[model samples]
Target: MSQQRHELLPTETHDELARESFVQALKSHIATRVSPGVREIYDHRVRDRWVSEHGAEPADRHEVREALSADTYYRLWSSVRRSSQHLLWSSVGDAVTRQADDLAARARVADAGLGTLRLDPDLEIPWYNAEVDIHAMPGGYRGEYMAGDVSVGAVYDRGVYVYAMGQMGALNDDYGHSICQNLLAASYPEFTPRRILDMGCTVGNSTLPYVDAFPDAEVHGIDLGAPVVRYAHARAESLGRAVHFSQQNAECTDFPDGHFDLIVSHIVLHEMSPAALRRTLAECRRLLAAGGLMVHADFAGYAGVDPVTQAMIDWDTYNNHEPFWGPMRDMDLVADAVSAGFDDGAVSIETVLTGRVLQTGKQQRAGQLTLLVGQA
Candidate 1:
């Protein structure tokens, strides 16, 4: 048990550690093994029987949901998974509140004046963010109750590790590193970017990896959450990675036109409304230099999915506070890219690697995860 939270009694530290560890262990079991067993039973026994009796399989995820809504196994699995997710955040929230002041102080003195964190007091938080807490996180990502509150950021940083259950690797930067590798090695072997940007970077978990991927490039990350950027800047500085983190909404930024040669986002699009997503894409175009590349990776892995898989995926939308997650999966990403002024031929899906990043990349808009890649 780490005394990571500041000014805490040893008893409090142990209590927090015990409680969060239990939740993380429970979450991992449900996510990796228990949930899969339920799915197996449904696929093998319930689904097959339903298909035989009903004279056809489920037409879509909706049909599957309706059919299995009352099933005991389905109900139990769904409830448990959703509860685990919520518990993960709440547990972190308790710890973060105790450490918020400490995190803020550390951010102020980190690295002895290294890196930058610029937050706008008047920055408008998008309606999409205000309406619902993404991923069941309390107060969402941007909410700050005090002057130098980092509770939301600290919770997110700690919770994601438990939420991911070590699947995201030790640094938790695989999401960005995998995307960068696939794009650099496979998609654009000839392209070498000089400046890079990451949109909606929560704690620079996905932002700092680009610093290593492009050693010579100036890496910048923007998000609407001020505390998260503060934490991200400090984290990057501590790791000796000079990343510029700013609190700016992705839909609009103050950067000069054609400022970045490469722009990327990780798991950001699904949390946005259609209109907001459009504006963000257009903004990407505005921020990108001529011949620059843009890649937005998400968990919209629809490739090879049948009704059963889709219905399982859909549980997150309604239960996890992801209002736009489902629609984002069905969006015509190539058409959207073209509408945003990207070359039609250049608009394509790159391979989304496995063992970490989910499959969204596919030729026909179906894959384990998705990658929307194009040039400005």
Candidate 2:
């Protein structure tokens, strides 16, 4: 007799097939666009020029092209992977835009929100402040600024919209939710959260997953970007999820002491300097009730991974304008969490999808570590 099949097998098999097709389509699209002339110019003008002037090592243009193609494929696949459930939810995107416009209008007349802040000169913060053009989006966060004036934010918003289209009906947050949900179910089954906070929740990509995972909890998402928070709130509301989106810095949230049952951040730490990271950790600790858990999902150091994978991961830091990523990877997360007053044993690191306890202190020497989950 044939072996019994798991109930999830059919769906899993279909998903894998869909992912494979999407990857192939992405690869074909990239290959077709990367004409020989374009490749030559990118190689000679960009790669070779940087190598000679900056003393950066030269990577073969063909190899780099192949890598770029692969990266594009993976990014596209990952984007749609998590949103498979809502892939048919067509109306949510429209709802998000409509809600955003309403919220933006409300924020303009109000004394608070992104409309009031003065840009810090020392921070070199790239987003706009006074007018509704956080990051130069027209009507900035308030959507009052004209699109022509806020070109940067407009382009950014367009990119997000385009990506969301590809996501079908999935929540707009990072693919982290599905991955984290599976991981928690398999690895940490003992914890049941009552209240959850997602930090640096730009546009709510990582925040909505917690709501799905812990249906009973009040999910709150905070970010420093006003426009992003407004945009995120609208998106969440459109999806019919009750997520409270607020504009607040992760370094010092205004929440009262020990109010949250779970605190999480995804792909947030690398953007900060060491000092900011410390403050964020302190804030996370302060917000967690006793026995509450804190989990951060971010990249791990390339300390122990195979050499090739490590190099590929490290390349992203410089090539993608993620200047602080390398430094954060080098920093010891365990030590950082311990310093914030969590007991050593109470803090643990694991993979968010696999439920595997990551070998802490083991660096991915060659390849970049994918995801690290730190608990406090």
Candidate 3:
């Protein structure tokens, strides 16, 4: 489903800080319109044409992408959609950059509770991170220009709303908020977590809500981007939430064995290589306390979805700079969880509806989604 039609877009009145110009806003709107139409054309026209000529459907997203890659409509959609993504960043970055120093200063003294920020200069950034701008951002998420800099993180905090066309709600924390409403509230009504970990938490947008959900829990957010974590720390402070932000990789962490009551990630699977994902899961299993839980919410089911839809999703794999999107989504999570030492019978999945989704008046979305869940 299109995030635009489902979730409301940010308006001039709602987010004056973004300062979107008429040209940039128009480009972003055009992109939002193009993204869904690309899928519509694929589902209605191209897939039908392929079936008519071949007598059989394309087996997967790759084949679908290949078949449509040469089509005029598909080419135009890719070009315009890609340009719009850049334009969205430009609109937010232009405004956010001007206040980078001020943001950094605020973040430095922003914590409201017994929270902390930890950075490891000796830590090595993974090759996937050092290799390319994963999301078509000019310098990438981890890029840092100076000490105590929050420019990249500030851009991300606002850029994501622009990218999602404000579908994530006012603060853009609905992705995390969804877990509390769907999985936490519905699945484990009586379970009370003592400690929580948000792995690969970029700006802690998805990390902050667990504090509100379980006020007594010691919440910690981890990622490789020092600047983002710095920004996240300040953000949690500004929101009056207690979250310890740290710079670390999820594949291997410094936490002791069985240290946390809950571990979670939101839409983080498609960002890493399969090996990294596997390693991360294994580490998650190691970090969870006995009787604790681990759950990760990802995108629309990859292998389970129609080929045409899968092809549309693959647009990220090629056009959006998400190199591992295809393999990560296509992975066999049950088997992967088993490989990670999670009990075979205890491993399960759920498609949780995000909170913003509920406000869209489409409560049925709760069942149509999926989340990979495991227990220690």
Candidate 4:
């Protein structure tokens, strides 16, 4: 199913919609039909060859990667997955390009006078973001083609739905909603934040949920992309949610120290390089008020996970242009948080099921997210 489009979303024509639907079905078929075969081939062919040559099962994900790298079936699966990622962007890009000017106009008019949009054209684009198109998106997240280019943001807003195979819910905000409702509310019921900040908030999909979760709290979201923040501000306005959106690097921002009572980020950690991530964590600590909480959530961690599973997760590092994905997973997030100035006892790395599972055909995959949480 397509997302429930708001005023800022590009209007798709019949043929564009059909192409997007086709791409979604292709992705679903690949996930359910083709992906499972990789495991089967590994078990029957790759593992057997490894045991015969090494005299023992593969010791770690590195060995698994070495063995799988030579296998034809694994390569095929990886190629297909990479192709689908490209197709996802291309399909969505068509609609966005056709209506780019109109969409920008709509965003300008859709402002409900509820929130604010702050952009800095001179803000430096970090090397990690400027280096490659993360997740194979054509323009990455910050590409601007025209004067008021919200095209890339629009592509991402819709592409995420098709990429996740519609598991992220109507607004693709399940990660934000799940953490707020299932994790934070249950873990700290009495805590009510006066000021909340979301870092690396691309298009505010995850940012707007905080407004609903804490209606009276001041909500602010910051990203490095002007187009993304612009679209996010308009989207929030159209949805009748008051959310402040700004284009600012998470590593260093204009906000004063200890300005936020609650700081959060959804699926943002892995996108950053180690140095940047370390700085961002320290900045999170610096921005957090006394007794305030900080939470950074992303895909499952690699610790204690089997070599084959690790290999599967690490696939993104090589094929998906996410050079930092594997290393980030292996890092000691709890230790990192402590090093960032949080009390050692107040920080922890934990995994929780979001219960937002998506079923494609006969396959059932777990919806798991890992969190690095700290309290100052």
The TM-score leader among the candidates is 4
lDDT of 2 by residue, 137-165 (tens): 23333332332121222223333333333
Q: Where does model 3 exceed 4 Å of error?
A: 1-57, 356-369
Identify the runs in model 2 with alpha carbons over 4 angstroms from their true place: 1-169, 306-309, 354-376
Worst 10 residues of 4 by lDDT: 352-361
- Go through the candidates in order and give the clash count of each: 8, 27, 3, 0
lDDT of 3 by residue, 1-376 (tens): 2222111121233354434544346555554455556667777887788888888777777778977886788898778778777776777777666666777777667767768899988889898877767788766768888779877887777777665556686677887888887788888999899999999898888897799999999999999888888888877777677898899999999999999999999888888889999999999999999999998888755756877768877888898889987887778988999999999898987776654422121122332346889999
- How does each model score on TM-score? 0.87, 0.58, 0.87, 0.96
lDDT by residue (265-341, candidate 1, tens digit) is 98899999988998899898899899998988886556578877788788888889998988888888888878987
Location of the lowest summed lDDT over 10 successive residues in candidate 1 = 358-367
* Candidate 4 lDDT tens digits, 80-185: 8888888888889989998999988887788889999999989999999999788988888899888878888898898888777677888998888988987788
Of the two candidates 1 and 4, the one with more favorable lDDT, higher being better, is: 4
Worst 10 residues of 2 by lDDT: 1-10
lDDT of each: 0.78, 0.52, 0.78, 0.88
Candidate 2, backbone clash total = 27
By lDDT, who's the top model here?
A: 4
How does model 1 fare in lDDT? Answer: 0.78
Candidate 2 displacement at residue 344 in angstroms: 0.9
Shift in Å, residue 158, candidate 3: 0.8
